[model samples]
Target: MSSISIVPTDPQRWPLHVNAGVHHWQYLDLAASTKQPQSVAEKYFLGLLTELPNLPVASNFQDASRNGFRFYQKLQLNDGHWGCAYGGPSFLLAGSVIAMYISETEIPAEWKIEIIQYLSNTVNKDGGWGLHFAGDTTVFATALYYIALRILGLEPTEPLVSKARARLLELGGATAVPQWGKVWLALLNLYSWSAVNPIPPEFWLLPDWVPFHPWRWWVQCRVVYLPVSYLYANKVTKPLNPLLQSLRQEIFTRPFEEIDFNRFRNTTAPTDLKKPLSPLLRAANVLLRFWENYIRPDWLA
Candidate 1:
């Protein structure tokens, strides 16, 4: 089957299969080089395999105009935009599976197949997945989805599982994942909470007028920070199970017990650090960590 290559604006990062057909952006060729990422707002397509059917020649120009309008109407949605799958990211898969598991909803067999298919079809040729299917393979994306697949009951014996595990190890294991990946693993209790950088929820209590107020951030960033901070503030985590315990051993490069989790709070793999953190943000995190660990007022509690 022919496929489209997506390029994002950043040229180094594009989430594979964005709102599929809705776009005013460019296309990219995934086969051009799997390691080379697309522009943040790009999506390239391959040559067409078959000619599309054309509308019959209209009796007159008015008839042709009416037919075109009718065709356009068929593609419009209730919201006045065409709907597309946007179903191609593996990172979203973990979040979705977690939400469903928490809500006690039953995901159908077809959904499981779709998720696996997306992952299989989009992972880098080296057998690792990226933050987006079109992006470079990363510890953060690889680890979360590795855990997601394990949770979905894929066996270790599966070839896909074997290749992914190899890729995870090659990337230096779970410790190399970024902060958000650490949070997800911590929530599952598969990784220790201490490894995560501080996310003190008291920031929420900051006055709105403050220049650095969380609300001043982008909507997705602010929204994610809020819940994660709340969860971190309370050190929230789930009970562990046999499968997770097994994963602890499987997904890491070093023996899980011997590695120092505290050392990696801000430690991300080289490839994943697209934008280096500003010293200002790092210093702030260090200071906040101290307060989080020892000096915060009980009233702030």
Candidate 2:
């Protein structure tokens, strides 16, 4: 079992909580908190903080139960049991920012600036970002934020972006990005919609008793997948622009014209690959591709 002491010992800096309906973290007062830092005695309240001496030495089972109850009671929070934290990952903000932008929702200026600052601060030392705060760079994350940063109005020529683009291209470019990235990029018109795997909305209409019924899957999986399938059926693409045209050039190591979108459909970086592709799924994809090309109904999409 792990203990709280196992957490890394950084100076006692406080968190700045930015709440825009959702909370975000920023560390502050590092210098002040660490300055004239507490001596070991002061930091842990010397021996007073430990229960070593006071802990019960039970003489029997009944005594042991009493001591256990006493210790457990001491551990309870003042009010209740529930608590939470932001659970840091680097990708979710891109989704929120993109959603706001697409819906034409007005983001406050402070939020926009803070979002950019957070992205700049989070860039990995190698210049690209990873899937999460501590993870190594992956095409999935790099592509998501690269597009997000652009949408937020950062120029491609900016040093952070230039460095990131170099790293992204080295990792086999945006074409090598995983399914999630492909979905977003297709929406941005940086990728062709046909290249993404199909998620037919008709699956939702399937009978509850069917073996592959949507309800049989985990609630969270089906909940997210339901809309993705609907959108995929639409084959949505953004109108072309200078930024997208530039992205097409910047994100690929190979000539864009030479890259076959269909070929890379199932390809994903080893680090970010969660599941191996099933043969059943691959066979299904072949049939779906045929349907998408010729047989699927227009109104159904």
* Per-model TM-score versus the true fold: 0.74, 0.69
- lDDT to native, each model: 0.71, 0.69
As a whole number from 0 to 100, the lDDT of residue 259 in candidate 1 is: 82
What would the per-residue lDDT of candidate 2 be over residues 21-124, giving only the tens digit for each residue?
34333334567656544322222321224233376789999999998777555443324332244424655787777667656687654455656777777889
Q: Alpha carbon lDDT of residue 140, candidate 2?
A: 82
Clashes of 1: 18
True lDDT of residue 68, candidate 1? 85
Q: Model 2, which residues run further than 4 Å from truth? A: 1-87
| Local accuracy of candidate 1 as per-residue lDDT tens digits, 18-121 | 35444422323455436654321222222122233466789999999988876565545434554444545555777878656544587655456545666777
Model 1, which residues run further than 4 Å from truth? 1-72, 79-82, 102-105
